[model samples]
Structure formats: C-alpha cells, structure tokens
Target: MPVGLRDRIAAELTAVIHGGDLKLERYAGPPGDPGLFGIAPGDPVWRVHGQATGMLTGGFAALMLQSLHPLAMAGVDDHSDFRADPVGRLNGTVRFITTTTFGSSAAAREVIDLVRLIHTRVHGTTPDGRPYRADDPDLLTWVHTAEVRSFLAGHQSYAPRALRLTPAECDAYYRQVAPVAEALGAREVPRSSREVERYLARMRPGLRVTPAASDALLFLRRFGRTRQERLVVRPLMNASVGLLPDWARAELGIHRPAAVRSCWDLPVATAVGRTLEWGLGPSRIQAAARGRLAGARQG
Candidate 1:
C-alpha cells in the first residue's frame, strides 16, 4: 500500500484501539521534561508499552482476568459506567496509562492522585453479600499485576521484530512497571516474569467466572465508537482470547478449538500485530518519549 494509505489505516487502527482516546496535544512540540517515571527511550518498556497492538490485546486479556475477582468485579459493576459509556471509560484508562508513562513527574503524580481518590470512593457489596473496596491493597495488587502481565505477554507475542524483548528485557519490564504499581498502593508487585507466573498461580484458586466477567467479555466485543471499529477489533479480540491462560479461556467460555489454536493463533496474531506496527510506525507520543530520554541523558 502507499504511504498515505498506510498512515491513514494506522491512524484508524490507533483510534479504534484507543477508542478515540489518544490525545496528541500532550505530546506535541519539542520534547519537554522527562515523565515521572523517567523511562529511557531505549528502555525495553518504551517499546513494549509503546506498541498499540500489545496494549490492546493485553488490556483485553487483563480485563478478562480481572473479572474473575468477585470483589473487583463488584466494584466495577457498582461504580463504573463501563456499559453506559464504554468509550469514556476507555478514554480515562488510556489517559491514565499515557500520562503516567510519558507525562512529567508533576503530571504523572496528579493523575495517580486522582486515581487513588477515585478508588477510595469505589466501595460496595458483591451479590453474595461480600464487601469490596477498590482501594484495598490486595485488590490493587491484583489489578496492577494483571494489567502489567497482560501488557508484557502481548508485547512478547506480537511486538515487531525490532521491538521484541529478550527474557532479560522482559524481567526488566516487570521492574520498570514496579514503581507505578507501588504508587497505586499495590504491595509486593512482581518484578520478574517467574515471580509473575507464581503470583498468578497462587491467585488462581480465588478466580472464577461471575456474571460481571461474562458481561465484560460481551461488552468488549460489542461496544465501540463505530461499526467499523467493532468489526476491526474482532480479530484482535479473538487473538486476545487465545492469549489468555487456559483457565481464563475456559472461564470466559471463549476457548478455541485445539485445531484453531495450533494452526491459526500465531499467524493471525502476527498478521494483525505486524500490520499494527507498520501502520503505527511512529507518532507524537513516541517522539515525546524520545525527547524525555534525550533530556534524561543530557542531565
């Protein structure tokens, strides 16, 4: 395809993945101060978290995993307008991730504080008469771990060759996200891939399907800003479902046939992933991140 067409396609893909939540304004102009995290442009995370494909697939998987937690699901179902305003919820999520990842220290802290306050207000009872609070440190840790793990897994599986991560790099990524997890009040967040796996394994006994989990899957597949978006994201969603842990896939009732898993999973994920990379080559967000890395190097 021509450059212009490719860019247009990439832009559309970006919009769909982000649910039109990407705000380039924050990243415009010459690179400013390093974000709160001070992540180097060359850091593996910059590549891992920077890829739109990984973020989308991993984010979807995280939500699926998170829904397994009854308390967490209760907090969301009771307090969130996710079903009523899916795009708005997505926008807020994207804003938080981008701000914390690329925003200056002050900006990042501001977003973190705001999120903490929101968490404080989100407390309720599960249908079974169990109390839940979003700010509970344990819950926070589950949410944080699930999200970061999904992001890393997606990147490992789908990121372009230039951005692929080694095992060391993956461990480095876990380290990279540790600060944000801590800032969010998540305790004992895993800092290595092995630790992450162990953490998930330990948590498995507590995970099971709930109505909210079922609803979450349906919501993700059916809601989008546009018909085209809903249609386009289906394959990515399928790929995401395949990426989930076997238990998670079974819980969601989205388990793929063994034939499909062996024959089609990797190729489909690769095609969608590479197309995303080609289309989303570089953008203002990355440029801003590069600028921060440069500034950090100078200082």
Candidate 2:
C-alpha cells in the first residue's frame, strides 16, 4: 500500500483501538514510572499484546468463550450495551485493556479501580432464575481465564517467529497476568498453563449454548463502524473462530473445515497482522511507558 493509505489505515485502527481513552501524553514525561507490571525487554505480556491481529482475534474468542457460561452471558445480555452500540462497547474494552497494560502505575490502577466499581452495578438474575454478578470471584476468574488464554493462543499462532513465545514464556504470561484478576476479587485464578487448562475443563459442564450467546456471536460477526472497517474485520473474526476449541466450535455451530482454518484463516490473519505491525510500528503508549522506565533507570 501507498504511504498515505497506510497512514490512513493506521489512523483508523489506532482510533478504533484507543477509542480516545488513552492520551499520548499519559505515557510521556513520567520518569521512572514502571507502570503496573514493571515489565522488562522480553516480558511475555508485552510481546503477546503487541500483536494487534492476535489481540483482536483473541479478544473476540474470549467473548465467545465467556458467552458459553450462561451466567456470564446473562450479565452482559441484560446490562451491557453490546447490541445498541457494539463498537462503542468494543472501544471501551480496548480502552480498559490498553490502559491497564500500557499506562503508568497510576493510570493502570485507575482503570482497574473504575472497572471494579462498574462491576459492583452489574448484578442480576439470569433467565433461568440464577443470579450473576460481575464481581463474583468465580465469574471473574472464568472471564479472565478465557480472555488471556485466547490471547496467548492468538499470539502463539499469529505472531512472527521471532516474537512468538515459547512454552516457558506462555507459562510465564499466565503466572504474571493473574494479579489483575486477583485485584478484581477473583478467587483461585489460574497461574500456569496446566492450571488454566484444568480450570477450563472443570468449568465446561456448566457452559451452555443459550440464545443470548448465539445472538452475541451473530452481532460480533457483523459489527463495525463502516463498510470498510467491516471488511477488514471479517478475516479477523474468521481467525478468531479458528482459535476456538473443538467443543466450542460445535457449541457455536461454527462449521469451517479444519484445513481451511489452518491454511486460509491463519495465513490471511497473519498477513493482516503484518500490515498492522508495519503500519502502526511501535505502540505509542508502550513507548512512553518504556521511556519512563528508562528514565527511571538512568535517574
């Protein structure tokens, strides 16, 4: 693509990802602010989240996985703005993740505290008379597990060879990322690869294919602000679908052939990821945080 078009695409994507929630300046001029993780050069969270394609794909898969739990889906179905303003909801989610991941220590905690506050109001009874609360420790753990696991899968599959994490790094990511969920009052949040797998397996019996889940999936497949943006989102969703576990695919009625998923979906998503990486270059927010850390070290 030409430089102008590339820049335009980059701008649009940046707007979509940032949602006007994080200012470029928040990351700058903060000497010695190591942010929440105090991540190093090769921190697993930084590397995994740096891949926009993987994050987008994994995020959608997380939604799908979360929708499997009727209680979780019920909370979103009743209280969330997903149907009326899907993009806006997406923008908010992007804001929270980016802020918590790349913002300064104060900024990161601010978003987390805001989310915890919001969760206090997100309580209701499900259609089947079951009660659900966003702050419920078990529910929080389920959401956290589904989300980060999906993200790791996306990065492991789509990120460049040099950036793709090894098994050890994958384990490291799980161990390191549990604190955010813990802070939100999640109990027994999984902290390793084996633990996560076992947790998901243990929770499978409680999952279902409710009408709300189906509607949510349909809306996700079709959501975008414009025709152009929608076009770009299609392959990303396909790649996300490809990332789902076999039982999840069956539950969601996803019928794509395995070979097509491996051959077509992965390649298309990889190409899109490369385009994003080239267009976006380094994430501005992360750069600012890194500068702050370097400034601290130098000081």
Candidate 3:
C-alpha cells in the first residue's frame, strides 16, 4: 500500500528531529572533558544532547503511533489546537527539553508534560489571576507548526521517501488526517493531487534519515569532528548510520568508547569514555533533537 500523509509526515518529522539544523545547535556546542565521557555529571547541554539522541532511536516510532503520553494529554477535543496538530505541538515541547532525559516512553512523556506545565505556568494566567485555557487551539497550532517545520528543515537532507500519491489517494489520506490537521490549524493538507505530489517531492530527501540515524550523526559531530565547519556534514553521516545493520552495533562499538574517538574528535574518544567517564548514554536522541530545534527557534 502507498504511504499515507500521516506516515510521510511522521517520517519527515522524524528526519528533521534527528539531523536537521535543530540537531546541529544541540550537538554542535564545544566539546566537554574527555575523561568525563560516560561518567560526566549532568550538564544542561549534555541532558539536552541525550534527549536528542533518544528521539532518533526507537522512541520516535512510538511517538508517531500516538502510544506516547504527551499526545494523550492533548486529549481529543476538536476545539483544542492540540487535537489538530498533536504531533507538531508535541515536537515543539520535546525540542525545548533535554533529549537525554527521554530514553523511554515514560521519560519522554514526563519531559513533554513538564514543558506544557512550565509554559502554562508562565503564560496561561492573567494579572487578575484568571488562568487561560492552556489548551487554546491558536497557541497549540503555532507551537506545533513552528516545531514541525523546524524539524523538517533541519533534516531536509535526510528525507528519502517521495510524497508520490495519486490525486485520489492524496485526497483520501488528507481527509483521514484532516481532523488532526484542523486541530493543528494548518492551512490545509494538500488539497489537490498536484500539491500533494509537490509536497512529497520536497519531502523525499529527508525521509531517508531516520531519527536514530540522525542522532548518531549528531553524536559523531559532537564527539568526533569538533570543527564548526563540519557541522553540516552530520546529515550525511546520519544517512550512513541509518543504513547500519543492528548486528554492527556491537562490532562497531556503537555504544563503546573507541568508537567515539574513531568517529569524531573530542575530549572523550571512546564510548566507555562517554558512559563511564561522563554518564552519557547513546539513548535520548529524540529529546536532544527536539531541544536543538527549540533552541534554534529561540535563537
């Protein structure tokens, strides 16, 4: 069966969250102490980095399936923007926090809830002490759209699947996802077949860069190259990482120290260095991606 709009959007958003400009900001910071690799104490940057890493791993698919809690928190209210653009809003909140914190579905959900809570605390009250509905559609739509587009732009190079849909198919799928889109308040979900094809064509290159692969690239960029100029090179590295077989993880020391050094130059050159020395794990790619995207928007 042909990939539907939801699937394509999911894939594209995944790519953006991984290797896009958002990833660059979170992982492109200056290298930290090598000795602290795995054993390093928690730092704001590291926490965010870890979260980005998790997103690229298995958690991304789970998030897409709506099996994640943050999505559920948005509820199914049509009047709420969260319903229209659950993915987008979720992505925005995720992008703002530390990626390392999102190693599991539970962790990711906690971070997301926290973000919403914080935002509400900051902006959802009037001077008269009346609490505005935290579930406003306009706010939700803006937040989700910004985050989603940022993720897509960041991972533009990794998109692989073409948005090739027959006019009929495009119309049908659009209708399916339309409720969600409407809740998100997106202008429209590609009304015509021509528009659908064009959107798909634009998004194809990014689909190839899976979330996990994008996280790997960010990992390499942070620990390996260390040069600002090489930041743009991570998407390519991510593409390669996505293609690696699961069997290669052990042999390649994907979770080990020596791999870090071989992959990139930094204070810590080994996976052991990152884990034992700094307490950083290869998980949390997704959170980190979200953080980076949020940071970019802020910057």
Against the hidden reference, what TM-scores do the models get?
Answer: 0.90, 0.96, 0.25
Candidate 1 lDDT tens digits, 22-88: 6554543234576677665678777777877788888888888888888898899899998888767
Ranking, lDDT, top scorer first: 2, 1, 3
Per-model tally of clashing residue pairs:
0, 0, 78
Which tens-of-lDDT digit does each residue in 140-244 have in candidate 2? 999999999999989888887888988888999998789878888898989888999999899989998899999999988997879988887888999999878
Q: What local lDDT does model 1 show for residue 217?
A: 78
- Model 3: per-residue Cα lDDT at residue 103: 29
Q: Which one is best on TM-score?
A: 2
Output the number of the lDDT-best candidate. 2
The superposed Cα distance between candidate 3 and the true structure at residue 120, in angstroms, equals 1.9
TM-score of 2: 0.96
Q: Per-prediction RMSD in angstroms?
A: 2.4, 1.3, 20.7
